[model samples]
Target: MTTFDLIIIGGGPAGYVGAIRAGQLGMKTAVIEKASMGGMCLNWGCIPSKAFIESAKLFKKVADAKSFGIDGIDKKALKFNWKKAAQRKDRIVMRLVKGVEYLMKKNGVEVINGEAKILDKEHVQVGETKYTCDKMLIATGSRPLRVEYKGIDQSKIMEIDGFFALEEKPECVLVDGGRINACEMALMLRYTGSKVTMVTESDSLIPFLDEEIRKFVMDKIKKAGITVYTKSEITKDAEDGVYVGDNFVECDVILNAKRRRAVLPEMGDLELEMNGHFLKINEYMQTSVPNVYAAGDVTKQFFAQVASAQARTAVNHMNDIKETLDYDKLPVNIYTDPEIAYVGFTEEQLKQKGIDYKVGKFPLSVNGKAMIEGETEGFVKVLSETKYGEVMGVHIVAADATDMIAEAVMAMRLESTVDELARVVHAHPTTSETFMEASYVAADRPVHI
Candidate 1:
């Protein structure tokens, strides 16, 4: 038996990242992954999706070339080579996957290619061979979910992997589900001139979004010419269209972009407590069984960054560091056209928690830089506790909102107050300056609106 100090199952962000950390701690670590080293986030999901988004944005931009002082362009007959973009997406995914492999080698973590079957908390079997470890981490991640709607043709369906694999654009697309992946696909394809419609089983699209942000996103979706139907299901199907609550919608493709379920490892009888679909973990990332830990999608921390953070925390605990990850301090981001990034409590969450909070907001329309960019369609909203001025949440809807959110995350992590945020010097004529401007509003002082 090949024995080691740590054996990580699943080489996604969580497993590979944790393996590197464990190697740094001088533990003999090996990672077992059935597929590519970087897992779905790199091979199929986040990286490829973003690549397509950038291309889609470029196509949209080219269509509005006259606004940029570039004339002699036909907007209706504008040409976009989607196959070239798809090729670029493949290249990007390959580059990142290889980079991760290099990192594993540099960190002295052995990369094993095989499915890990849990023999016990301390041993895992891959094929006919068994490997033993002093500590085990189950980071099996999740599989792309496949939902079969009633009266839907199976041939029209495409999952995330299939959507990215397409070299040509479809004429019309019906995106099933209402969560992150669905929203991303709908936007990415629609920007490339596909007639898109979003159908969800929920009451509203992205229901967890802050009410203001949700409204902003919905308005954008509508303006992009993508139709949405919430609380609707596919009832019957015809040759070309499916009935969505008495309305017939035609589509060349039906994207099954539902929320993926956690890929529970084959753990015969070695029981681990599960919370709904994800493996239950403690503050230290320890599973119910000692010396066994779980992280990433398997534990349902779907964000790639969060998965990596949780993985490091698990490794830290194994080395007696006693460090725990504070998920509350991390930003939850959605990559819409103008983007949506937020950290901490939403207004709804604050009200539900009964916390006394005050709000300060600055629209992009008032921002000098946003006006300069000609992409001024969002806002920066700040929330602070009334008594101590402690920052409760910061929400942004702008082009670079995802990047802007980390500052808010750091502020909350360091326990900074809204007054401090307002007092800080921000470079002029930048969207980030809105953070300070919004803080000024929260502090009862007016700046640039």
Candidate 2:
């Protein structure tokens, strides 16, 4: 029987990262992955989705050339060659896969290309080969969940995974999910001239965000010409398109964004403390079984961004580092036209926790840069503890808000006070000034409204 010091199952972000770290520590490590390296994020989820979004953004820029003081562009009818777009995305994915392979080789981590089945706590079986390890890590990722409904098995109905495989754009697409993926897809396709409708089972889109921010996102989505349906349940049906609550929504494609569960089919032998379908882990990311760690989407944490953070935290713990994973400071990004990004607690969360807080908001219309760019559609909201003036949360919706949230995340993680943020001078005529102004407002000293 072949053996190693560490064995990692699943080749997604967590598994690959852990494997590399283990290899660097001079541990004999082997990673078993059934599919390509880099898992769903590199292959199908994050990278591919972002590639399509980038193309859509470029298409919009070219179509809206007149707004930039450029004329004589009589290209009225813009077309999307989905085949080439998909090919571009696939090439990028291949490059990333090769990068992971290079990392594994450089770190001296053995790569096993096959499906792994857990034979016991110390043993894993891959076809005819069995390997034992002193330590094991289960980093298997997740897949789109299919809801139990009548016509869900039909060809017209699709999941988020199917978006990459689509050779052509659908006439009208019905997207069901209230979170980031659903809103982003609805906007992307709508911008490309597709009739898009978003149906959410919840009361508002992005229910996890602040209620005010959720309302703002809903309004933006509606203004972008995408129909928004809230408090609706999807029933199964066998039709040419998607049906919502018995109404046959004439859609060429139906994208379901219900939820994702951990992919852990080979975990039958090892006992796990599961929160629903997600493996339960402590702050250290240790599972029910000792020396067996679980991270990323496989754990109860549903946030993809948080999953990567947790993976790093788990690595630190494995190396006997003292740092504990703190979800309180994790930043989240929702990739819409006017992107939404936030860190720390929301106003609602603060109220629910009974923490005395104050909120300050600065609209993008006031920012010179936003007006200059003609993308003024969102705002920055900063929350602080009323007594100490310590920054608690920062939420933003604007161009590059996804990247801007990093500053706020750092502030919250460092426990920076509102006064500290207000003291820092931001560049003139920049979107970053919004954060400075919001902090000023939080501190009750606003220079600009």
Off by over 4 Å in 1: none
lDDT per residue, candidate 1, 1-449, as tens digits?
99999999999899999999999999999999998988888888888888989888878878777887888998878777889998999899889999999999999999989888998888899999999999999888887675766667878878766677776888898988888778878898888878999999887778888898888777888888999998997777777868888999998888877778799779976899989878999998899998999999988889999999999999999999998777778889887888889999899999999999999999999889988877798999999999999999999999889999989999999988989999999998799999999999999996876
**TM-score for candidate 1:** 0.97
Instruction: List ranges where model 2 is wrong by over 4 Å.
Output: 151-153, 236-242
Clashing pairs for model 2 are 150-236, 151-236, 151-237
Clashes of each: 0, 3
lDDT of each: 0.88, 0.85
User: On residues 1-449, what C-alpha lDDT tens digit does candidate 2 reach at each position?
Assistant: 99998888988788888888888788899999998999888888888988888888888878888989998777666787778888999999999999999999999999999999997789998999999998888888887776766646566668897688788878788887888888888888887779988888888998989888888988888898887778887675545565677766767777887788888847657888898878888888888887788888888565566766676666667778746766889888878888899999999999999999998889999899999988898999999999999999999999889999999999998899999999999999899999999999999999888
RMSD of each: 1.3, 1.7
Error of 1 at 98 (Å): 1.3
